[model samples]
Target: MILFRGTGAAACRYLESDRSRADDYYLEGGTALAAFTVTDGGGEVLATSELDAEAYAGWVDWIDPLTTKSMGKPRLPGEEGTTKHGSPRFAEMVVNTPKSLSIAAALHPEVSDALDAAQGDAVAEIRRFIALHSVTRVGPRGHQEVVPVERLQTVAVVHKTSRAGDPHRHVHFQIGTRVWAAGKWRGLDTAALFKQQGAIRALGTAVLAAHPGLAQVLDRHGLTLDPVTGEVAELESFNALMSKRGAQVEKNLAAIEASWDEAHPGQEPGPVVHARMTAAAWAKGRPQKRPTTLAHEDGWRDELAEAGYDPELFLQRRLPAHAPIDVDDLKIQTIASRSLDRCAAAASTWTRHTVAEKVTRIVTEHGVRATPA
Candidate 1:
């Protein structure tokens, strides 16, 4: 599953800071920063040495002034309001792995490669969609323009376990808000990017399904496909277990909101108020348990069997020759079509140029690359 969150400049600053403790190593003596970019395309360089913290901080701060600020009052006709600066300058894209895939990655080298391939495919699809759909205004009259994000910079951080010490594998994609377009930097229009999150998630499942061993393992462990969508479900047992902390956070937030409402009377709580409440809830914290006390892989398998999945049948099943569908091509076409349709509906005069330019760029960029699995 892919979870998305738009963050403020302060959050971005903290994420790049030493206090963030993003120091979890994937390899011996290796740093957590896996990749960084400034483009929306697939070309990103993996870090050879340690992450350049100063560069990351600089990038985040450069776009901070461009973030949407509080207006303090309502606007008159033609007056710019909160959205004048566009959306938030930082967003987090979290790609979560299934329990089966997580365990497989830990226990088998081949599975790790499959996981990497699946993750790569998902990320590429996401970037493609964002490139095609990102829209921004160019002039004082709020002229709608399709500013395709040619380069999207991101810091990909992989985590092996959850904060609760559960067996979890996920990648945090810290995407910068600025993109190169029309010979200068522009604030990214993330409305479409956020809208197509479901399609992006489906692409991830489809790509993972292309890996036969991983699919079978997932099936045996109760991450079976939904009959209608062919999308796999996360192991409910594990998901529910790990959601305890989040549930508590939600509960605390609710209580805080209620108290604020009672005190404030008719006034609605704003973003800043909600943010403070959430921060206080997080500060309260949850008890940590050692991972050593968690259930082993075998225990999880046994639990799956007990949950009514046919482990024997899952083991006997052969790998499908192909995925249930052409995930890569289908996703690309879907996003492009959606973007073009929206442009047409909006009576955009630049529709032809936008479509032509985006198509040419996508084809030229991906033509030399191998097809995704």
Candidate 2:
């Protein structure tokens, strides 16, 4: 599962350099948060499963509109975690909203509910959340930019082959702030969402007691059960528990592998045997030849020279210094520039006529601005 947050521009920047690595990590169920303060800092979520390619495509189709593009690239593996640059694709990080306000909580109704919902509708819920929080506003110069918010960008769920996560799935979402229909954005105090005693208690019962011995080890590792909910606690405590559990599980697996090697020295089968009787199989037809791709001698001249092989011809090709900007790049650059402009405006003073005059001059000279609406 990959959770994306922040501005599309920021997300694009992160994606360009490490798209492959990011995808690799995403398959591992990592969350990626991006937000563009200069643009609407909405968020998006993606879950990765071993679905067939068609199912994967279906998932993308369901999620594409909510996000900005088909090439779903979260923050590249090495970029900073937060989305600060303004990208049209950028959205906030999504995490668990309060149980009361969470759409997942509402859909599930009961924590153990197994009811299935339509994929389209589920994706709609996600899109609704993004649109409801996306920034859209006109500034002093009637410039548009996405306003930044500390919203949950995404939640990721990773299903492992073994008893990872006690088989509990889904990375939760917690969103704060509201993007109103009136094109205004406001912050929502979502701390109350985390104050659920029942949830806490449930966590304690389900995860903490799943394996009691492991629970004791978790406690020894500075991980503790919450007093009020009797559930495994969060923040640093949850991380500590996970780390310790992972280490123990790894150790156990290593021990099992070592034991297997000791029990069976080289091969597990009884013993290698040589058969006494053998008959030769005859092929009476013409031999099959391997196929090869067409080779161009013209292009091989440079390589041939380097390898000390003279060539009769050389291919001359001129490559451009830069490729055309893609939609994502344009969006990111626009958002970034706008953000810088906003900052500059904030740090300075201005008069209304001065702004109007500038606008008038532009309108008079260019007739209209055609770059971005």
Candidate 3:
């Protein structure tokens, strides 16, 4: 990252902040600054602000002022080990060199899109891949680690490339500091290491699975995939295209989860196995299979109440001794659980109903099937 004048200076100025500000405030400022410089948000979200367009234009104006044809590409001063044609040899060298003995791939443009899309589906697809492929975890001398969902922080970068005009574009990615299990760090845990390896390999495998046309995609951009590792090759091919035009994609899992909660605010995040097991135990101990036990109704009522359904609602419905029951249908029932719902009912207000609808939408993503009958 060399500091070219003009738009780069503006961007740098935005990054430079008053050191005296509080940490939280300073962070807000930085985010605001980045937002102002990169977005066309139309005055809504900072990250989408229109200032980005202006800053970019200013940058281009500075870089190619006067719009005159030059002898060749302008040389960047003090850049060493680079070709006279101004190729970024230093970056190329770093990426080409193996990070460890294992066949390695640096985050680069050629396969960046597929790499990115792979991560999006990694959680589910990778688990499936690991189960299918007999890939085992490499112990102390391994190439990966899997942090629990709670411990992982993911970031995304988009890579691009081209040949004649655009040249290569690729994304370089770095996973910041790892989180240890149970807060422990810096010890050899081969089992844990292998588990993590399974996860990382899953990510790589999923990328190819999700986007089988990656080689073709690269070819369209004057890039090619490395057949051996199934990755994109050629730095100048992509780098020159994306030099200052690429972007870092943001992963918004937290937002998605929050939306999920809005859909099913009172629903549990884990499996329903325990609830089913308890129901099974109750079913097994019934006498004469009459199924009208006070204990059974009470248990169902209690479970429903705990989950936000009004237990009394179930009582409003008729149940009989040894009635034909669909086991799945008997598993659960719904009622508004939040205090807001209660308040709304008391005041005859409609606002809570709207909020509840929103929350229902959020929770439904977790496999809760609700149908209006």
Candidate 4:
């Protein structure tokens, strides 16, 4: 799954942090050093092809002040990336692995290499999605035009566990919002990325499933991806046990809501208030993370052991001989038909994004297994 969040120069600190510090001081992510630089909070920091000292400086306003027009004023305070207008300083894309893969990698340390290979493939696919869909929106009032300019200045950091310390492998892709287009810097239409998150997610998963390294490794480890749902069906129940983060968040939210209800009798909170309440819950529920706490093989094994789970039992659970449908035989049109039906149930109106997402749903271009960070 891919979760999109609008952030700013702050994310560079959290992702690039190689020391012992959490960048959760405030919502805007926090600031980093002025030096040109750049995670689901992935462990090791990996810069995208476009990221460099200059680009890093550009994002943080340390250098190359961004603006919509070539000769316009530089971006003001709190408007680092929005100098191009309305776009965030960064578009955060959180890429997560399927439940089964997370579980398998958690149990077997050796499976991490496969996960790494898969992550590479997944990153490639995401870049493709960005290149194909993201554009620069420009023009006068009510005469907006979208220009094709697809590329992201991203800093990807790898991580091994969820906030709850579960084997929830994921990647945090902080895409720089400003882009070079039409001979000047402009804001990439991040709304396009945000709106099409669902599509990118599905497309990413499909690509990961088809990835030879990840798929072959899973097979070697007695794990298999269920074609229909795209999860390792055998470990569904086990995977459900690793819902500590979700459980904690929900518990905190409920407690906060109840407390509010107790204090404010007969008064319902507005969306804005409710949102604040939710954020409060999230803040309260956040774990005091070390970021490298569960990095070793024994750490994860001990966790499973304490939970009374025998890792060997998982491998022995086995898989069916072959997939129900030959993956190679699946057609984009067939996938599109089913996806269209599902979309039709929700709304009648459809845009290119809607159709593209439908294709993303069933299109198995490839797959990624996130390695330990």
Candidate 5:
């Protein structure tokens, strides 16, 4: 599974701070640095600065000074803007654990390499998907045209456990806000990116399925899968346990929000305010135990069995066979079908030519070459 969330300066600070643990922050493709230059679509350096709390809180003025003044509200350094609504300074793509591989890695430390390989493949797929799908429109009115963003710069941070100290392997991909395209920096068309998230998740699952050894490990561990969803139900208990801290934080936030609403009357707080509140709440409500003890394999399996999931069935069941289809073609077809379904839902009619044109535009926009018939 993959989740997307827009983050503000406060959140960015939390990620870079010691609170998140320095060891978990991974600098993909290079070593870590205090500050770095933001680049344009052509890979030209735009600005050099550290993306610490100060930078994010004061970024609106630097990024769009004219607009900041016109709005009549100056954002203080370290303060998430209270008036700004839709402008997200950064985006996070959370790559979640594949149940089978996660369980395997937890039980047998030796399988960590295979798990890493699978995760690497998942990340590569996500990067390719982003390259092809990341786009923005340019020009005015009728002259508007869609163009792909040529580059994506992200810091992929891997975490070994959930906030509740449960064994949860995931990556937080911090994607830069300003993307390069058409010889300039432009805001990413995140709506399009969000639309393709499901496809990207499916692609990750497919990549995992390609690794037979991982599946065999799942079988050995007694993790049964749902015949229909192909998802392992046994992991739900673990997920629920891991989610306790997060659930508490959310509860605290909800209470805070309610109090704020009561005090503010007709006014609604912006994303910045919400982010600040959420962060504070999270910090205050964090569990006392920073690290959790890993259960023995036999004990973990017993717990799963106690949760009513049959371990015997997990051992007997086999993973569904991979469908024989070209991965690229499958992606294209899936996107096309989704597009058609949306059109149908909207009661919009399209001729064959129109559908073909739409698909062609998507293919061209993403730089996907058509497979020879």
Candidate 6:
């Protein structure tokens, strides 16, 4: 799955890369943690490719990246109660690996390595999508027009688990909102990113499913990606087993809502207030990291063993060898018909994007890929 979060300048508190202690190789701009790093491309504006605490502070606060001094303009009379520069500092896209994939990674090093490579490849593809669709508005009010721009300022932080300590492997791909377009810093046109979340999720999962190393590893371990759901084909039952974190959030939300109803005595909250209440509930529900003597991966293994999952049985060839699929004209016609029907069902108005997303859905669900020359 993919999640896009709009963030103000001060995302560093949680957005900072995990700083675990281990034997580490140094990166170009800064030190490397086991999981991720902060990078910078140029020294001018956003400077780093990885996450930088000081530079990020400056970047979000509208200060010079090198100088770390405030460059924020004095607010205009009407510009009260907004971000430092009246624009969000960054947009975060979370690319999450499937639960079964995460469990597989914990079970084996080869799976872990393959998962990393697949995730990297998928992230690169998503970046290309961002570069192609990124835009900025130029000119005044009614006369304004959107122009394509580049968003080179990106930081990806790979995380291993959810706050509730589930085996959730994901990357936080944060795109800096400061885009250099037409010799000026401008806010990115995030409408594309927001509007195409489903497409992004589909594309990312498709890449994971077809990745050679990852696919080979899965096959060896008697696993395969479900063409439609894009999760471990044999592990549908894992959903109920692995939804601890999400379940906690839901439980907390219910409790909070109950309390709110009691306090308010029959008053219904407006949309804005309800949204804030939900946010508060999430934060309240978020679990703090519990200190563990055993290594995290080791702990996951123990849990799996206790759950009665036999590794030997898992390794045995379970999925059948591929049978020849007849991709005849009728199959093509059926796919087309289903794609169009899905588009119609999804929206009243249709555009190229809508059709494209629906087609992608149909293609992925069937595990279809472009024929190589």
Clashes of each: 7, 38, 37, 17, 1, 7
lDDT of 3 by residue, 1-373 (tens): 1222222332232222111111222133333222111111121111223223234233222221122222123234344754434321111000111111000112323444444344334332322322232122223556655433222211222222211111222222212121123343222222333333423443433244224344344444444344333343433232322222112101122233356558876443332432333234333433353222212224323433444543243334423212222224422233334534544665665443344443333232222222111
| 1-373: candidate 1 lDDT, tens digit per residue | 2222222333433333211111233445534344554444444432222344444444444432223232122222244664443345456677777654564454444555666766766666555555555554454556666645555555565666544334466766666556656666666666655655545554444444454445454444444533223234433334454333544655665677678869997465454665566556545665564223333444434444555546355446533422343334445775587657655765656434455444433332232122342
Off by more than 4 A, model 5 = 1-9, 13-83, 98-101, 140-143, 216-246, 249-373
User: Candidate 1: minimum summed lDDT over ten consecutive residues — where?
Assistant: 16-25
Better of 2 and 3 by lDDT: 3
Tens digits of per-residue lDDT for model 2 on 1-373?
1233443332232232121111232243433332111112343333222333232232222233234334333343346863453112222222221211111211122321311111122223443334334343435546744443433332222211111111122222223233222343332223322232222223222222222333333333333323223233422222322222333433443454356547776432211110000000001121242101101212222322444432122112212211222223334454445545544575575443234333322222222212111
Span of ten consecutive residues with least summed lDDT in model 2: 273-282
Clash tally for model 4: 17
Q: Which candidate is the best by TM-score?
A: 6
As for lDDT, the candidate ahead, 4 or 5, is 4
* lDDT of each residue in 1-373, candidate 4, tens digit only: 2222223233443343211111221114333332221211121233323334334535534233223123223454356554334334566666778866777776666677777677766766676566666678778859989887633345555666653446666776556566556776677676677777777767666666655556666777777765446677656667766554656765676688789879997565655676576557657847674323444446556665677766567578776734433455676567778878868976888776777777655554322232212
TM-score of each: 0.54, 0.23, 0.21, 0.65, 0.53, 0.71
In model 3, where do residues sit more than 4 Å from their true spots? Answer: 1-150, 161-169, 178-206, 213-373
Instruction: Tell me, by lDDT, which candidate is best.
Output: 6
- The lDDT values for all models are 0.48, 0.28, 0.28, 0.56, 0.50, 0.59
lDDT of 6 by residue, 154-226 (tens): 6566766654445667887766665667767666677756776666666677667556567677778787766
How far residue 154's Cα lies from its native spot in candidate 1, in Å, is 3.2
Please tell me which model should have the higher TM-score, number 3 or number 4.
4
Better by TM-score, candidate 4 or 1: 4
TM match of model 5 to true structure:
0.53
